[model samples]
Target: MFPPLCCDSGVDQASRRRHHQSRKMAMLSFWRDGLERQLAAVTAAMDTLQRQIDRDAQSDS
Candidate 1:
């Protein structure tokens, strides 16, 4: 689901751990960005609904 992580040419365990951590961090970042975007969209929608309700109530006066 993501581009490959940058990895060292060495085959030692530390290099492998670095590569794993890099990939994990990348995935987390991606997920966080997506969640934040969705939250913003929901918040905007709620604000719009509230405005419409308020406007309608005022018009009834």
Candidate 2:
């Protein structure tokens, strides 16, 4: 999911900075979680591959 593009109505630049930082954090939250899930899946796949390779090597010995 993408974060909404919002316009800041604050007259002060500091408030605008804070608002954008909050928005960026919200956007990254989804991506951070997603990457963690993907990493877990890749790790599981590697483990499975390693096990299969080990089995094959044992059979060949």
Candidate 3:
């Protein structure tokens, strides 16, 4: 949850900026990790399909 915005509060703006930046970085890292996992799965599937295709071609020849 985001902190409530106040009109006359004394919260340090620098600290708020740093907090937001850290959250953004964390989100980027999480997405990057998820993308890497998806890429690996796709690569593995492609390799399997290639092998299957090769076997079928050899059998037909």
User: What's the lDDT for all of these models?
Assistant: 0.86, 0.84, 0.86
| Better candidate number, 1 or 2, judged by lDDT | 1
Residue-level lDDT tens digits of model 2 in 1-60? 343376656547777677679888988998999999999999999999999999999999
Better of 1 and 2 by TM-score: 1
lDDT of 3 by residue, 1-54 (tens): 465466335658787778778998999999999999999999999999999999
TM-scores for every predicted model = 0.78, 0.66, 0.76
Give the candidates in order of lDDT, highest first.
3, 1, 2
Error of 3 at 27 (Å): 0.8
Candidate 2, superposed: residue stretches over 4 Å from native: 1-11
- Winner by TM-score: 1
RMSD of model 1 against the true structure: 3.8
Question: Candidate 1 vs candidate 3: which has greater TM-score?
Answer: 1
Minimum summed lDDT over a 10-residue window in model 1 is located at 1-10
lDDT of 1: 0.86
Winner by TM-score between candidate 3 and candidate 2:
3
lDDT of 1 by residue, 1-61 (tens): 4434754466777777687788899999999999999999999999999999999999999
